[model samples]
Structure formats: structure tokens, C-alpha cells
Target: MQPTDVSVSGIGTYHFVYKHDPQTGESGFSHLITPLGTYRTFSLFTSLGVERLTLVPWALEAGSQNAAVFTFDWETRVPPSGFFQGYPLARFTWPSGRRVNRLWAKRLVVYDNIQINWDKEDLLDSTSVELHDSVNEFNIEEKRQFGAGTLVTHVRGDLTLAGTKRPKPKRSGLLTYTYEYEYDLSFLVSGIRSCLYEPSTASPLWCHRAHIAFNSWSGYSISPLGANHFQDGLSSSLVLSQTGVQLNRRFDNSGRLLTFALQDSKRQEAIINVTFVYSVDSLLPSDMNLETIEDVPLRTHYRRGPGGRIEGIEYETVGSSRRRHVQVSYNEESRISDLRHYISDSQFAKAGSSESKHITTKFLYERGLLSGFGSWKYTFDEDGCLIERKLRDSGSIEDLFEYDAKGLLRWAERRVIPSTTSEGQQKTKLEEPFCNGLENACYPQEMGQVKDYAIQYLYDAEDRLVVLRNTLEIDDSIQFFYAHPQHRNRLTSFFHHGKGKAYFLTYEQQTGHLFTIEEVDLSAAADSNPERKVYIIITDTEGSPIALYSDDKVN
Candidate 1:
């Protein structure tokens, strides 16, 4: 037997396969399984024919086995004249167990009149499914000349389920389902054509009405759901028209209303309003853009404070788009002092009531560098470093600095008066020291209150730093070690914190460039996990060269 011919109401399983020519360089294939005592059906809708194959296994009674197969070639007829639509269809059933149905459609066509089959199972319910019409019955020509026409569809049933014990139900059940789709069409006209005809000059002379809807499960519900209206552009800026929402109440609830308001000016009057509603929450931001707020104009102003610091600032947008203004003020210590806002145009009259305060500042410079200023005086060493600082207010506060023979700041001690009346009483607040300048003068070598951390620098004959050693503050505490090239230009720096480990790094000699880094011998450690090894590679400007390659898995 042919693969397409499968016995109905039998105890066996059936398998079907289908193949077709590629469309847009892609093809689809599906496999279906039918259980025993049931029949299956397949359907498709397309302008092209389909090749199908089916396999059925015969019923086995008392150690008896048999196999059966069938194949079939099906094609849909082309359209006669105006609109043409097609889909693939199939169905199957076994004894009294289960039944399967399927249908496939490619492109949907629309014309003056068209009919669709709803029983076609290949039509999957999806958000992308839509029905469109070319010539709407509500157009001006149809209303003024031909009058309204009827659009309907007739659906057929599955033959296998027709006379069976439990026949398939009607296509449209009691509760109807409505689906509404909305779209806009616009065309631009030349200036010369627009000048001759006032409507033509308006660019988009038509604006579609909102709240049009459609229902598919109601057998056939037709009205202005597929309607189009023309508009004049001379004196009107916006046009509103609608369809289908009137026939189905559910359609009214599911449909959307759109408003097309137009404003055209010679300079900057063109505007478009987009309203999107989802459930009970809505978002609206007026005149917002990528950079600035177009709905409000902003004026800039600056306020001065002690030591030339900004104390207060205000932004005024009077006679602006929203008639709103804002002001902010700060105190002598650069703290926010006051803030005020006005929403009405008349409130701007109170802007003159803003208050201002005056502050005084004194300067104390050592070798042209600010050592200490304010209500006090300070002095520094010859190298332009703060050696002593004195605060001359109610109480006395002083800080003394000391340097090593190598001219590096070694230590500093601070002294403050115990109380306002006890001018002679002093107490030490803090004491810290520095060992050497390794990385740079700004980043010292020895740092911390306990002098537990120290760093040593090795320089070449030319005084160029070649290598650096970082040590812990405790005696004989060596955290880790690093080595650098003697040539300063070829030297590279790296940082690591660990114990009993060697880290390796590759660098370019000529450019002093770092190429790669690898941990030398920690792979066998108890904490090592194979998956923890990470590899990183660096590329050049053109992404061509492997400038660096680092891996944590090393031994």
C-alpha cells in the first residue's frame, strides 16, 4: 500500500514524512506519530503542491506481524480571477483512541472579495497572524458609487470525524474571540503638486481613525472593521475615523484607539504625540529628547563664596515653555543652604528676596606652595615641603615634620591644645613615618603608623629606576619577590600578594611593553582547581597581533 494510505480504525502506529522545495534557502520538516486504534489526518494550504509519505504498521494478533506503507502527491488549484488563497490539509484516526489534524498556509491574499476556511488545522494561533484587505468597502468610491458589499467565509469539516460516534464541534463556539490589527499608510507629494492642490500640499492629507477591531471566532462579523476614509488638508490639521469596534463588544475592550494630531509651522511647530497604554499603568514625558528637556527653558547663573568658592546657584526659566523656575543656595562651608521652586509665572517676583552672606579668607604660602592658610600660618622647608604648621585661633594646633638624610620625609608629629583656656597644654594626636621613595615621591616606600612596611628601589647608573622590592613592616618578613630588566626602557612593573610563589611576565624590550603573565608553580597546590585556570590574551590596535597571553595554569 502507498505510504499516504493508512488504514483507519485499526490497531497500529503510523509515521508520516513530507519534503518540499526550499523557499528563501530554507525548508521545514515535521514528524508525527499515531498510536494504535486511531486515525490521522494532514492538511496544508499553499499556492504550490506538496509531497507526502506515510508508514503504517498492521495489527499483530497472537504472534502475527505485518507492515503497510503509502505515499501521496497533493496540489492546490490556482486562483480563478481576483483573490486566491491556499493551504495544506490532512487528518488521521485510529479505532476509538485518538485523532490528529493539520493544515499549512504560506501567503494570504486579499482583493475585493475573499473566503477563508477556518477548519484548516495547520493555522496555528499566533500573534503574527493577520487578515488584510486591498479595497476597503467603506472607501469613498464604495460609499458614493458601488455601495457596501458583504465579506464572508464558508468552513468545511473533517470527513473522518463527520459520521463518527463523537463528531467534531462547529468551528465557532459560543464564546467568540476577537483579534484587532492596526496600521498606518502615508505618502509624500512633491512641492509643485502640493501648491496646485491645497490637500496635495499638506503632505499627509489623511489621518486614519482609531479603535478598529475584528473577530475571527464569530463565523463572520463584518462592518467598518475593514474601512477607509479620505480627509481634506486645507483647514484641518487632524482627521479621525474608525471601524468594526461597534459590532463586537469584546472587540471594543480589546481594540486600541489612536489619535493623530498634526501641527506644522515654518520654524519649529511640527509635533507628534505617541500614546501607549498597557493595563492601568501609563508613562508620559513631555518634550523629552536625547539630551535636553524641550518642554522647559533653563537660565544659568553663578554665586560666589569665601575663597572664590561657589556658595549659591540659581536657574531661572521665566517666560519659558512651562513658566517654572528653580533656585539653590550654599553656605560658607560649601554646604547646601536653601532651595526654592516656583511653578507659576507670578512666583518669579520673589526671586529678589534671595539672601547672600560674606566670608573672609587668609593665605599662608611656603615657597609659593600653600602650606597652611585660614585663621593660622604655616611654614615649610627649603625643598618646598611643610615642616611646621600653626593654627592661631582660640586653641593652638601644630604639626612638625622631619626628613631623613636622603631628603625623604621620615616622620611627622601633631600637637594640639587640650582646651581653649590652656594655651600651654599640648597633646599628641598622631605620629607617622616614611622610609624611602620607591615607586615615586608621591607614592612613598614605607607607609603606616607602625613603620612595618618598607620598599627598596634599585636604579641603573643613569639613575633610572630598574627594580623595586616591597617588604612587610615586621622584621625578616618577605611577602614575595619580583625582578625587572636593568634597562629602564625595557623594565616593566607588576603587583602580587602571596607566599612562596613565583610569577612570570613577558615584556617587549624596545617598547617596555608587557606581553603576558603566568603563575610559575602553583598548579599542584591543594586549593588549585582545574576550572579555575583562566587564560587572557591582549591584542594590538588593529586586533591583529597577540601582544599578550596569560594563563593561570602553570607549573
Candidate 2:
């Protein structure tokens, strides 16, 4: 049914059909007609359960490149008709209709939101492979509890591929971590419809209950821990047995987190702790306390002015008489106008330190856009893209930039010249001979004195950077390679014309987990052995490189 009145509340619903014509008694409303013919029909007296079935278009020729996939699996085989089967839309069943509580008498447990096929097999796979090697692989196991409904309540994982051969106490300098969760069932808002009287059902919500870690770097294992929960169903405290580390949390009556502390149980001292103090009349934090395993604990107090704008901040450290203060002034639009930082000189402060060591920074805005700050002035286009930045005193361009239609940097240039008063000194400094080991610095500065340098970026049709050349080295540039089928979204190799070197990258997986780079020298002597270097990248759990190891001296 369609409504005659229009409402712009919420997301502003719109009627897509054209207006009806009363003269012709015709309504301009039609169902979306697709090339695929009707595949299923429902009887006039079909059960409402059929509404739970969902069918999606599945084109046999669909692929990443949008080209026809010639090869087909047995499950996705095409028909012999030349016209070709329009699509192979897979049917999926929604779990809402088969929820457990609705059919409690049947004594059956149903996993909420888990898609299943006709065979009652789960479509959502919960397995993940983190790390794999020839000897071992690291996998994480998720455990779900099935009482009223299914909910993940435990997580068990280990990092042991590189630790098997090491001593039990020193397991390849890695940490094995585990997590456990606790949940509580409560009734919460489910649907949003004012006219409908849908009842809210109680569901289980999980919360972190315990975190365990075995740090091989410290040659110690943290034993399993059990924690108690607060009235709000939050973990209140956790204690690690083997390792003398304890975590504690405190909340206010309103369930607002007040403090969280990580303590060394053996010494009965907090290693790191943070506390939030709220104002008596407002919900905002009035002050905060941060205590690390350092010499002193730092306290920051916030002072708010009219409109609840923070006007000042005061910092004080325990066992120290001196304090640091920051004064903030805001414009009419509530934007920070200026900030002044200085050391407070109270009677208990150090004798020599005073407000004389203060630093002030002012911000200038034009039409709601930042125009200048400190000794630099910036010019931006209508779209708020910074196009130029120059020194306010000398009016000399310090940096210039041009962006493409999509706001990606297309050209950039930098001009570095000392101020008029210091040009002579800078020239002398540039011409001065450096010590035996430092010649590249003076050589580069000498070349920069001749003219400004600019760089041009060239991208392919996919908007992937392909070439980069600079004005200083017009004939030499860097070329990137992504031609191979395996290098669709990953960089395969890059050649540096200026350095006469080509570097190839290798990953642990096909398109992820970069692990190594092999550098080859192109300018090496023909008869002599060419110079080559291989660098190994060590990555962490998120597939981010944490360290680089290479054997340059040996090579």
C-alpha cells in the first residue's frame, strides 16, 4: 500500500513511481522488469513462511573482470542452449522464521542470523587461517554456546610455528594470546515502527571476561584467569596467576567507566592506570589522571568556559612543584583561535622557571577555512584543497601542489631557499666542505641552489601509480610493474632508473602478507658477479611489517 502524504523524517522516504493521472485513471507504477524470466511462483494460499526464503541473481559469467568465465565447476555448469541460462540464482533461507524461542516447545536451538541452504548446512564459514608454513599453521578456533541461542563465548589461538624448536621458556620470542567472553541476556529494542506492536526479545550480548597471554620474550606464561562482572555486566577484575599482572576496572553508578588499572600483583603497585573524573553538574570530564610505571603520575584538569568550551588545561605531576598550563581562546564560531603554553611559576615552583618560556600560536581563518598559522600562509582552492604555502615574511613559495579531479595529488613542487637575511650564510654553509664521511648532504644542497625541483605523477587507467619523475632527474624515473595476472591489486616489481636498480616483492600468500623484497643491480659489471640483496620483512598479526632484517655487510 502507498501513502498519499509525504514525510521527510528519518531518511526521508521517497516514492519512485510517477504521479497518477486521474483523467486517464492510470497509475504510473510498474514492477522492475529484468531479463531473467520468473523462476518461482507462489500459490494463492501459501504460508507466510515462504517470505523467509530469499533468492539473489547469480550470473554464471560474473567475475572480477566482468568477463565471461569459460570454465565452470560441476555445481555451476551452464546449459547447452545457445541462448544461455540467464542466471543461476542461489536460494538462501533466513533464520528469523526458525528462531528457537518462538518454537520453545520443540526443544531446538537455532543460530540467529546464520544462513543455511536446503541441506541445513551453514553458509557462513567461521574458520580463519592466520599464519602457515611448511611445518605448521596457526589457526584460531571460535567456540559458541547453544542454550537459548548461539553466541560466541570463547576464542582460543596460538602462535607456535616458529617456536616449536625453541626452548619451552623461550619460544621464538613470540606471544601466544587467548580471549574468553561472558554474556548476559537482556531485552533490547529490535525493530523501528511506531504503528507495529512488535515485542522485544531478550538476547545474549557478549563482553570480554578474561585476556591471557604467554609472553615468550619474557620467558613466562600467564595462567588462565577468571573474572567477576559488575552489576552492568562488565568485567570488574581479572587476575593472571603465573604472571603477577592484575587488571581492575571501576565504574560509577551510571555505568560510566571511572578507572582502569593494570597492576603488578607481586609488588602491589599499579604499572599503568587511568582515571576519569566527571563534573558534578555536567557529564563531561573535569579532569583525568594517568599513572604509568614511571617516576611520577600525571594529572590533567580541564577548565570549561561558556558554552562548555574548554578554556584552559592544567597539568601537574606527582612529587613535582612545577606545573604546565595551556590557555586556549576560541573564536565566535567556537573554533580555537590561539593556544598559549607555558610553565607555571608558583611559589612552590622551581626558582628560575617562569612564564618567560611561553609559546603562543595563532590561527587565522578565511571563510571557515584555515588560511595561515605561525610564519606560514596557505592558499586553498574553492574545494578547500591547499594549492600553495609560502613564508609570510619573505612571500617565497615553500610548497606548491596540484590535484586531479578526484583530489589525488597529481603534481608537487618544493622550493627551499633561505631568507634574504640568511641567504649569504646558507650559501656559505652549502659550499663548506663536509667531514670525510658526509659528502652527499652538501652535494644535494649545492644542486638544489640552482633551481626549484618538481615531480610529476602518472597513473594508469585503474588509477594505479605507474610512473614518477622529478624535474631534477628528467631522464630517470621509477616504473612500477603490475602486468602479471597474479599482480592484479598487488605490486609485483619496480625499477629505479636513477639508482639503476630493480626490486621484486614476494608475499606469503598470493595477494597478501608481503614477506620479502629482492633487489637486483642493473649497473653492475657484465663479467663480475652482479650485486643482489634480499630483505626479510617481519610482520605482526594484522599483516603489517614491524621490522626489516637484511644481510648487507655479508653481501
Top candidate when judged by TM-score against the true structure: 2
Give one digit per residue, the lDDT tens place, for model 2 in 28-137: 43222122221111111112232122222222122332211111112123223322353222222221122211211222122232111111122112232222222223
TM-scores of all candidate predictions against the true structure? 0.20, 0.36
Task: Report the backbone clash tally of model 1.
Answer: 42
Total clashing residue pairs per candidate? 42, 0
What C-alpha lDDT, on a 0 to 100 scale, does residue 521 get in candidate 2? 70
Per-residue C-alpha lDDT of model 1 across residues 365-404, encoded as one tens digit per residue: 3223454444456675433346775655643456666542
Evaluate residue 201 in candidate 2 and report its C-alpha lDDT on the 0 to 100 scale: 15
Superposed Cα deviation of residue 188, candidate 1 (Å):
61
Candidate 2 clashes between residue pairs 3 or more apart in a chain or in different chains: none
Model 2 CA RMSD to the hidden true structure, in angstroms:
21.5
